[model samples]
Target: MRRAYSVETVRAAEAALMQRLPEGELMRRAAAGLAVACGDLLRRNGRVYGSRVLLLVGSGDNGGDALYAGARLARRGAGVRALLLAPDRAHPGGLAALLAAGGQVVDGPDGLGVLDLVVDGITGIGGRGGLREDATGLLHTVTRDRTPVLSVDLPSGVEADTGEVHGDAVRADATVTFGTYKPGLLIDPAAEHAGALRLVDIGLGPELPEPPDLEALQYADVAALLPAPGPESDKYRRGVVGVVAGSERYPGAAVLAVAGALHGGAGAVRYVGPGADAVIARYPEALVHAGPPSEAGRVQAWVVGPGLGDGRGAEAAVADVLAADVPVLVDADGLRLLDAETVRTRTAPTVLTPHAGEAAALLGTAREEVEAGRLAAVRELAARYRATVLLKGSTTLVAEARDTPVRVNPTGTSWLATAGSGDVLSGLTGSLLAAGLAPRDAASVGAYLHGLAARHGSDGAPVSAQDVAEGIRAAWRDVRAG
Candidate 1:
């Protein structure tokens, strides 16, 4: 798992690590990494030697890092200019070192010519809100010049912890963060501002806690979580997933949902809805039932409400599935009909999969608010429903009501925005739940595989929902092979 630490945790870890090292040891380590990244970036463009690199310097250690890194670049025969926002408050040691290395300080870069790169050391994790007047103006200058920027730790103006960008901030081409990954580097709006992230270890790991604030599962992690049938395991022993979906008006919903479940680890799929005929037509092996989910025979877990249009029978289907004595994953129309008290009082685990609009309705907030604050929205939904909530969008996030870690999925592409994709996810996750994974694991692993499938299905072209569902088997094979 790739972990992201909260700002407070990172600060505590850094403080502990700094106490054992020499006074300037940590900063030197950070500056050396920053300089290496800058050199590489310059080398990629052409040559680091004789290249012009501008440092947008601010006060505190952030500026010190930029100045120290500038000194390194200057020694390499690069023309390093320091645009000190606070000349008087600049780090004395770092400034003297830069001057000693033949680096120059300039009040304005307006007269400077084209630069290879702009280094943003205007703010560290300590700074909050947005960029100040001086930093903002300097940022505009670099933006107009079209110089690719490299932020020292994080972008200058983003909220380091919450990833809320309230105002103007530096948009970096890449960021070389030290020690650990901060919350802003993983969560968006701020995450979007931080381009390609590169973490440079400064030996703060020993001081930090093992558990992280947020995490994303890698291939090996997913592979371990995936269920593999044993030699003695039969279809029933492996698991059976019951899907209550599709209305007469949207029969394809049942087909799509069943598609995902079939491709998932589930040995059998028992589908209960009005689209029984349609589902059987597409997947003949499915055990179809037109009755309520209560009469659909035994199933290890249940997936409710995909394409369950606001029809009369859809209500009964949702009610029956919710009453089941197994894990339940609610999506689409089921989310619309969900009651706070009912879901909260359930003994079995419940997972709610809601897109921005559905999540908005659940929290009684606007869709825009949910999109802007995905982490908070997902957490709120999980707490309110007392269940695992998967908020799907550009960044698919899975959160639980418990104090467990939140999962951020980074494998998907924009092509997954097509219709029926979410329904496929709901069914796949339900299959995992039936296969004995916990609610959080089921949701997160399902999302990771689903997104990975979409990426493979798309492969740069537009992919339909069915194509993505079909690609899940290939994605599963890749994960298992990994």
Candidate 2:
């Protein structure tokens, strides 16, 4: 897993490294890494010797890093020009080095269109919300079309800790982050603007403090975390997922949900709903019950509310799941039907999976607001409900009520938004819960598999929910193959 710590942690680490190193060693390391990355970018585009490069330099150390890097490029025979955002405050040492290396500084953003690359060093870790008005105009003028942008330390205007954009932030083609990955580079909002991310080790590992506040699992970690059935494990031993979903109005949801449950490594799936007959017709292995949840046979965990409308039956089903002392996953209409306080009081772990619109309703905020500061919104939801909240979107974030580190699911694609897809995710996640995975792991693994399945099923085109479910076995194999 690639872990990201807060800005404070990174600063402390940098400070510690500085104390142990010779003067200017760390900055030289940063500048060297930047030069290498920029060179790689030029080589990838089939040129380096004569490529035009523009450096948007500021007053801080970040600008110094870029200026020194621009000097390196200039020495390599590439035409390099620096646009000084803060002329008076420019790094004295960096300016002297650039001038010595035959690099020239420009007074403004004019005539920057012909450059093949733009290195944004307008702000660094200490930067606050948005670009300064002066910088914003320059960014707008320069960032049209597909010109690749490489940001130093981080993209300007993005909050390093919260991943929130203050006003206007530079959208980079790639970000060259130093020392360690910042929380914003790994989380959404800020992450979305960071097109591609590359970490440049600046030899500050010993100074870095504790484990990160947030993490995104790589394939190897996910592979290691997956559950496998042993000889002693029977169908029942694997796990049982009790699903109270669908209704007279939506029988297909029950079938789809059961489809997901079966593929989710569940030994058995207990269906309790008005759509029992439909679920049985599609998935005969499912034990069907046409009654209330309490009367249904025992199950290891429960998944409620996929295709469930806002009716008495859905409300009662949610109540029964809440009453049970087992891990519960609530989704779809169930999210709209229950009160956050009531769900928070449940004895067992409760995982709520809601898309932006559903989450908006739960928090009584607009979808736009929820999306703008996704990390904050999800954490807020978790704290308010005292449950683990999974905010699903371009970047799915799972936050626990306690101080447990936040998990940002790196999986998911637009193709995964087909009808009934969320139902499959709920069922699959619930099955993981039934199999005894913790609430956070179940949600994260489920999301990873779902995203992989979507990619496998789509084959780069459109796909349906059935395709996604059918492809889960392959996705699981892919996850394990790593």
lDDT of each: 0.89, 0.87
Q: How would you encode candidate 1's per-residue C-alpha lDDT over 410-480 as one tens digit per residue?
A: 78668889989988998899899999999999998999999989988988889999988998999999999
lDDT of 2 by residue, 1-482 (tens): 77788888888888888998999899999999999999999889867798988899989799999999989988998888889988999999988888888888888877665778899999977899899888988877776766789999899999999888879899998999998788888777898888788989999777776667888888988787777889999876799999989987887788888888889889999999888888877888899887688788888999999988865678878887788888999999889877677797888999999998988888899999888888888999999998888889888888899888788888778898789988999998989999989899999998989889888889878999988998888889998888
Error of 2 at 390 (Å): 1.0
Clash totals, every prediction = 0, 0
Q: List the residue pairs that clash in candidate 2.
A: none
Error of 1 at 124 (Å): 2.6
Worst 10 residues of 2 by lDDT: 204-213
